[model samples]
Structure formats: structure tokens, C-alpha cells
Target chain A: MSIASHALWVACLGLPALAADRIEGPGLGSPVSAQSVAARNTSIYPDGRGLPEGRGSAGDGRLVYQQKCASCHGERGEGGSGGHLVGRGPLTGSDADKAVGNYWPSATTLFAFTRRAMPMDAPGSLSADDTYAVTAFLLYLNGIVGADEALDARSLPAVRMPNRDGFVWIDAVQPEKPR
Target chain B: MPPVNPSCRAIARCVQSGGAVRAFSVVLDCADTMISPDTQREHSAAVAAQEALSMERWSRSRLNADDQAPVAGGGLLDRRLFLKRGLVFSGAGALAWSSGAAGADQAALPSLRVPGRGFSNYGQPSEQEKRAIRWISANRAVPGNGVSWSPLHALEGIITPSGLHFERHHNGVPDIRIDAHRLLIHGMVERALTFSLADLARYPMRSQMLFVECGGNSNSGWNKEPLQSRAGYLHGLASCSEWAGVPLAVVLDEAGIDPAAKWLIAEGADAAAIHISIPLKKAMDDCMLALYQNGERIRPENGYPLRLIVPGWEGILSIKWLQRLEVAAEPVMARNETAKYTELLPSGKSRMFTFVMDAKSVITSPSPGDTLRSHGLYEVRGLAWSGRGRIRRVDVSADAGKTWAPAQLQEPVLPMCFTRFRIPWNWRGETAVLKSRAIDESGYVQPERDKLVAERGRNGYFHYNAIAAWQVDEDGEVTHVYR
Candidate 1:
């Protein structure tokens, strides 16, 4: 018997055959709850979409930074074992210290990064308010924000960074090089 | 996983006391030995001669007349040599067997004198091969935050043993429990969903042999001076494996992906919680939630329970220890993408999200730190790969691109996987500069170091895929050079 004819016969006989035009896959995933996703959905977007309700000033952040992030990041964010969080330098030079104010194009990144992966040894341990406070302190250290400015979900993303227009996306239309 | 005693500082070291460096001495205990004193010297010499002669002759005879002829200036044999035709092994084997019989003492080894050691549940490499290891280059204060390079110089063929696969960890490796782990595919979808390991197994699964290379794999190549280290340390931040898992598109399709979701914010569960942004278009094309490596469960360091295998892209795109994948419209512009992975050009503008690894090749056999032993005839072996596609050709030059030779591409050279290439060369004790350039199916050629550096500028450290040059000194030592 021909393979196609055999498959047809098998289908006529009510035997299961591979579906050719079926686009939707074998649904196996279980629907996740809001509470469960909230626990893992710590992704903070560039437009400050995932920022939670939190408020802190540089003064509030100084205590949090010294207590939790100082051992590795040094006393004043000048950097030690951890990378320098303060100071701005040329991106092309040998000593391009990619501190908070100089390199990062978005202010929301500081909150997201610090909230998700800061303190080196202990990550995601800081409270939302503490994380916002630390973000403010680091921004202040890099001269992006004032020492007493209270940063929250509303005001954090609004703060313009020094190197906001520093980065350029891949321009494919331009002439190609060896890179 | 088999126990790898990596803590041993000095591997393959012999205990030398009172000027005695011999491994096996003439044993007076004849009752426990296989050979007696009278014929020991004769037996030893005969054995050595028979073994060496047979090997040289047998290897030489395997080649047909067409294979014997050199295709290029460096005595490069035809790539067709790999596709050996006709029944020629018996003739060579007969000759080898007769020669060995003449020196009958060449038969049994000391190991065959007694029963061998029992089997292991998971077998490790021979104790004598302990020299092979991933060379760790971690920071003193933060050991786990650095990379341990795969010892590509000490290995052969294509597939890097899973244990020795290169590791580039932003933070330390996280100990994730299989039962507790969940892959949440949420955000910008019609219905948010999370799949457990068991749930994922029910979906259609397939495996592909792909390479995962760090964007910073050859970052050192950006330096003014070529690094003087093993070929692995210089370019070992990449690794290949038969990654088996469900297609990522299947899961996304089940979740009913939103049309506006153009990006994926992949976050790992490690201490770094490494947040990375990948294009949604690429994710749907050929990404996989890799559950297995080399037919076994993935190693903990290489992302055990679940990881994304972004084919033909940088290793960082393949998020290890994956926890949450948030579908979105824009990139997260995380630390890695902004502060680190971005390249600073001469124009003072930094280039971001440059993903594809370009075509590149390195002669692994006679690479740096390898001393070409007598150097009459040698197989110039190396690995060539292109993240864009399969390598179309790899031309080797022994005299600094003055003369070129085509190498035999080992069979089953899959796309985005390491394609092993080899060519026979006759080195007449002359100082030579060795070079290998890869041309991918996409027609992308590996650029020279000078051309690459000149175009990339001094500060662009990531995505370096330049042709590697190895200088063969007259003394038989090989070192890296920028030619």
C-alpha cells in the first residue's frame, strides 16, 4: 500500500495520525497565578514599567549602601573589589570607569540592577524602598541626582542621565567593518 | 557527574628522590614480573622499534595515491582524504602484525600481566591524561565571578568533553533544585504560564549540535600585543554540545505571544540574576530550552535543569540557570548590554546588541605552548566555526599567507558547530608563520589581526573573531603572534 493511502485508511479506521496543518502545539503549560509571577517577575524595563511602590533619598540610601554594599564596593563607591559605582571617564580611554552616571543611558537600570543583583554576596535581599534609596545614593555619587532628592517609581525614570545619548544602536545600513 | 579531582595542583608529576626519575625500573622480583633479566633490553628495544615503525607505516599506507599528493604549497593533502574508499586496512594490518610477530616481545603490556581495575559507574579519563583541565582564571577575591577556560590545546576532535566545557559565570553557579525550579514564560502574552520540568518533557523535543561562545571569548585579541598563553586560554570561552530540549517557540506559541512583544528580558536565577535582552524574532527562529547536553542532563555549571540555547549567537544570549523570561517591546538595557557588552568605537559612539559571532579558525594542534616534536611530517589540525552558518572553507598557510592550503573538513560539519579541519605538512626545520582563515557559508571571511584591530578601534573589546597566527620557531616551539 502507498504511504499516503495507508495513512488515509488508518485515519478512516479512526487510528491517530500526525496532524499536518495544526499550528497550536500540544498544550502542556499550566496557567501561572498573579502572586506566583509577582515573586519572579523582577524585570524592570527601560521605561520604568516594573518599578514597584518605593521611595528613598540619597541620605536614606547612604545608610543602606554602607551597611549592605560597602565591603566590596568600598566606603564611597570609588570601588575596590567590586566595580566603581561613582566617577565618570571616557569610554575610549584605558581607564573607562563605567560608573552609574557616565555609561548607563537609563536611570531605571540602576533600580532594576541593584534590586535584582547587588550586594555581591546577597542579592534580592534589599527591600523595594532600600533599593530605590541605594539607587538614589549611587546616582548622587555619580552627580546624576541631588543628595536630598527623593527617588520613587514616578521620579526615578524621569531623571535624565549624563550619557543618555552616548550609546548608538547597530546601524545596519552603514558600511560594514571587520567587527 | 564523574569525580574530577581538579584540586590537585601538580598533575602528571613524578616523585623524584635521590636522582631517580624512572617510572618503572628493572624489577628483580621475577616471580611477579612478565619478563626476565636476560632478554629485557633486547625485548624493550625491539618493542619500541616495532611500535614506532608500524605506526608510521600504517598511517602512511592508509592514504591512496590521490591522498598522497599535496594540494597546496605546505604539502597539504587533499580534503578528500577523510572520505577513505576501498578496503585497504587488511593489507596494512597484515604487514603490522607480521612486523610485531618478528619482535614477539611487543605483544603484551604490563597492564595485561594482571587483572585490570574494576569499572566505574561514570568513567573518567585515564590518570595519565590528568594534564587536560579547564584552566581557571578567576579573581582572587571573587573566584566564581570569572571564567574557567576549556583546555582546547589538550583536546582533540570536535565535541569538548562536558566536564571540560568552558564556564563564564557572572556570579557563582547557583544550586537549583529540579523539583523546585520553574520556567515562567510571562509578560506581553495572552495568558501567562509557567512550565515545570515534567510539563516541559511532554512537549515535542529535539537536539542540535550548536556552539555557545561568549561575546567576550576573544576579547584579549583586541589588545595591542597577542597574548602568550595556550590556544584554549586565548579562545576557549566558546564550547559546543548536542543540546537537547523543546523548541522555545513551542512554549511561546502555547502562551499566545503578543504581537507587540518584540523583545525578551531573560533573567537567570544566579546571584547576579543576570538580566539580558534578546530579540523576539531571534527567539522564535531557532532557540531551545536546552534540558540536556551530550545525551545527558546538563551540567550544573553549564545550566543544569534548564537553559536557553541561542544558536549562532553569543553565549550570554543562552541564559544559564534560567528562571524568568519576560516578553516585552523594548530591551532592558541591563548592565551587561550597556556597560559591558557594548563596544566603544573610534567615533566615541558605542555599538550595542551586536550578537552574531563572525567566522574564525585556529590551528589547535601546533598552537601556542605546543612543541612540534621532530617535525618531519605533521598533521596541521584546527577548529573553524561561524555563528552565521557552516564553514565553507578553511585555508591554512604555513608561510604567513605567502602560500595557502585547503584543509579536509571533518564529516558532519553542522551549522554553528565546531568544524574540525586537518592538513598534512612537511616542516623542514624552518621558522614559519602558521595561519588559518575560515570562510563561512554566508561568505564571511575571518579577518587578519591588523585589519580587525584597525577597523574595531582600540576600545572595542568584545566580538573579536580574527584569524590566529602561530609562529613556529626553528627550535620546534610554537607561540602566538600578530601577523
Candidate 2:
């Protein structure tokens, strides 16, 4: 059956018997503009594109972390209700607390996470500057960056995580049999 | 009538004359309570007069019964004993009422008869079964950013009643108006296309029974001490249903996915605006754009109107309130992927995108909070499933992990749906531990607790499928403990 007819049938099942409604008419009364929605979801590639235009310093991040994040995350990023942000020790074999400095595989992930859903209460409330500052503070807490070092999209991706070389990809070559 | 004992004779005489005698006054007392005050005297007299007649008949019946008596289990009686329907009197002085006169007496009692009410558009379960509800464990500060466990123990049958399905909300559920909802396909597509709910509904549809499990389920197992909870409370974040919708492949084809597109960023329309990056290969392979669940439109708690149903993956990736699908060259590495769903490892590395829920099984009955109640022959029942494939066998060990026996799996074990398993267990008095392990069709046997810890490290939190143990004491109390 045509996709249109199938959709019509589902609609008939979901709603009271109404006459066939045309798919076209004022963009089906959608609230948001198609162009704006598309623009909002810019693609962030692994090789590094779609990074937002902003920069921040670890020294600046210290002020931002104290003002916005320290209440739940603790002063030294030891973690409280929110999780610990700093690494405990080495990033090789077992016995590591694998937090910011040690565990995270990519610095891009840290930037995306903080930008989208951090600070718990007021998510997306922070400006790009504030997000970069917070990211820098977390990196500094994990001992990845100097206290005064600035972080931007280009520089952020280059900051190698301590545990970067520790991981071994699932050996698909000889798939492990179920035990 | 035959001569009665002297004690009975005195009481019978008092009763026959309607005298105020307490002993041997059963007939008179019954008549007094049943009849009105004005007719009580007459009723008592009538019953008293009938008692002498009944006594004469009883003597004749005794003679007839004595003459026709046979040995035990004789006179049309078989050697096999039949279960009795009515109450059995075991104590002395207990009376057994026969059908004819006893039934008539019972029917004469006053009773109120009222007709009950009728049907509704939507039906609720019986009022007595209201305890079957999702136990909400939401974040106190956030309105709806927590998990609610499906009450699996309270439910019977495979399908989780739509109302009580477990919920894991990152943000509060949004009341999105269906008429206003539209899905925009953009990014690395040849042609950017936007489809309304009406337009999407027009696509060819397919239905399959599948389960969605949250990746971080059973994280409590990572704790130093074994957490005490009903099996469902700990692992109830997963549920199975018959999801029907358009194949996502068709949509991707229509949008003309660019050859360079490797990842698809799926975004939701909630206040959190949750987004996640999914590989293009998986999305085009078995993923479904689900509109209906279990033969009905999806419940609001589950993505109403539309959702992406990715088979054999964690529930979070199945974005609800689907607003847009942006094809891309690489993963967005959203917050869920980076910080939240990622698990910190002891080796100073984090495990990201750990999607599949491995094979796991737990004995539902005779579990914690239930007593064995002098166990003799008891049924051990549990649920088992695997995201990789269908469950092949479930081995239940009653003596901890020492000995194992094959369990009976219910038929039609569809891939990725809950398959119920049962086995007959005869329990002796000694304290014992019970464990069940599921082996999927892919030859993946569930890992033991110690083995899991060794492989995944103590600090790892997600995808915990360690064999769970329930210790049964001599007192018949079952408790969760590591054996």
C-alpha cells in the first residue's frame, strides 16, 4: 500500500472517524520553521566540525565552577550528589577512578555534554563562554590543562585524555563465544 | 420411634411442648429468630410438632439403611477417592448438613440483591489489583528526571499492562499536540524533507514484538554491598511490546541519505530536548519508526504519536517525542554518550555507547519477600531475555551454583521479548540458595557474579548481568545475598 494510505489508516484507528485530511496545507500547521529546526541540529563530526564558536580559560573556569557548579559537584570536583569530575590516579590497567582527566575517551564528548545538559538545574542556561569555562575547570581539576590555559573547539579536541591508549576495541576478528 | 436416652428424652419433651428449655432446643431457637414476633409462637409450635414426625421417619430410615448396608467403598463406589466439594468436619460435635433441608434453610435468609454497573471506553484492572503500579524513583529536585520500575512480580502474562510500563525520563513528559508535530529530515541528505504525522503514517508498516532496556539498569549491583530489592525493582527498567510502524529505511531512502552520512542524530521535543547519535547502518538495518504499541497507539509515557524503535539496544537510544532526524558524517557525541551513559572504568578509561543488554535471568517466584511456606512441591518461575537474540535455555540451580537443572521455557520464544521459564522444585529443610542463568540463541551463557566482576571490574556500572542469588533459610525466608 502507498505510504499515504497506510498513514491514513493509522490516523483512522487513532481518532474518531473523520474525512480524509490532505497532507498539504500551510505546512500542516507546524509551529516551528523547518529551516530554523534544521539549523539548530548542526552535525558535529568525530574529525571535528560543528563545534560552536567560543573560547574559555581554566582560570576563568575556576570562577564559573565556583559560582555555578560547586554547590553539587564539590570545590575540588571530588563529586557529591553530582558525580566526581577529577581523576584519582593512573589511566592504564585496573584501579583507576576514570573521571575527567583519566577516563573520557574524547575531549569533544566533554564539550558536547557540558554544552547540552550540564549544571543539572539550569541546563542550556549557560552561555558558550560559561560552558567553555566550566569545561576548562573540569580539565584543570583532572590535571589535563594549566590553570591559566584557554580552551576553544580546536584546542579542546587536541587535549588527549589520560586513558586514551588504555582501551582495546572489542575484538570482532575472533568474536568471543558466549560463556 | 425408638426409645431415646433419658437425658435426650427430657430435653425432647421440653422442646416438643415449646417450653423455655436451653438444651435440645435447636428447632425452637431457629424458628424464633426466623419468624416475626407475632408468628414466633405459632412457628415454634409447628416445628416442635414436626420434630416427632421427623423422629419416627428417622427410625424407619435407620432400619432401611441397616438392611441395605455394604462394606466400605462398596455400592457403586470406586477404589479411587473423589475430592469432596463442601466443608469437611473434623472436630467432635460438628454437624454435617445434607443438601435438601439445609439448602432450603440457607435460601430463606434475607439478602440484598443489586445489579452492578457497566462498561467504559477504556478499562481499568479490578480495584483489588491496584497495587500493580510503577514504583516511581524520581529525582526529588527535578520534576520527572528519574526512573520508575515496572512491578513485574505483581503482573502476570508477558505483556506489561500499558499503564504500568516502567519509565526512565530524562525530563518531564511533554504533551505534544499530534496535529502540530512534524519530523524534519535534514543534514547530510540529498533532499531535505519534512513529514507531518499524517504524511509519516502513509508509509508501509511492520509489526514485531521487541523489548527496550535502559543501559544503566542494575547499576546498584556495582555497590560494595549487595542491594536488597525485588528483581523487577532493580532490573525492571526493561519491557517488551509489539511495536508497529514504518521501516526507518523507507524514510532514509525517501530523504536520499548521502553516501557520506555515517551517523544520524535523533532529537526529541521535550524540555530537555534530548538528542543522541546513532550509526546509520543500525538505523537502516532493523530500526522502526514506531507509531503503535501492542495493537494500540503508543501510550504518552512511551513516545506518543511517534518514536524510533531500535531493536536489541538500550531504551535511551529509542528517542521519544521524535522531532528531527539529522543525517551526519559522524556521531554528535551528545551528553548522554559522553558523560551520563558512559561508565568510568578502574583502568582509567570510560566505556561509551555500551548499548546491548546482555543475557540475564532471575527467579521471580520464591524470590525475596516471599516465604517458602513449608515447601514440598513448588513451582520456580522467572523471566529471561537477551538483546543479542532469543533465549535458548534457562538453567536453575536450587543449591546455589553447585548443581543445575534445565527449566521449562514457555513456547513461541520470540527474539528480544520476555520468555517465561518454570521448573518444579522439591525443597528439603536445609538452607539453600537459588539462582537462574539464561543462555541466548547466540550461545551466550549468563556470567556468574564473580566472573562478571572479574571481567567488568568492580567500579564499572552499566550492563550488569551477573547471576543473582536468593538465599533461603530453614525458616523459609528468602533474602538476597552473594553466595
Best by TM-score: 1
Query: Per-residue CA lDDT of candidate 2, range A66-162, in tens?
Result: 9887765678886444456777576445444446676666776677766666666776777888888888888888778888888887887788766
Fraction of native contacts, model 1: 0.55
Per-candidate TM-score against the hidden true structure: 0.83, 0.74
**Candidate 2, which segments miss by more than 4 Å at Cα?**
A1-38, A91-95, A171-179, B1-112, B343-350
Cα error of candidate 2 at position A64, Å: 3.5
Task: Superpose all Cα atoms of candidate 2 onto the true structure and report the RMSD in Å to 1 decimal.
Answer: 20.9
User: TM for chain B in all models?
Assistant: 0.83, 0.76
lDDT over C-alpha atoms for residue A105 of model 2: 61
- How many residue-pair clashes does candidate 2 contain? 6
The per-candidate count of clashes, in order, stands at: 0, 6
For model 1, how does the per-residue alpha-carbon lDDT over A1-179 read when each residue is reduced to its tens digit? 34466567668877654422122346878898889888778877666788999899999999999999877667888654455577677766553445677778888888888888876677779999999999999999888889999999899989988777777666222223211
Q: Provide the TM-score, chain A, model 2.
A: 0.70
lDDT of 1 at A135: 92
Off by over 4 Å in 1: A1-24, A93-97, A171-179, B1-105
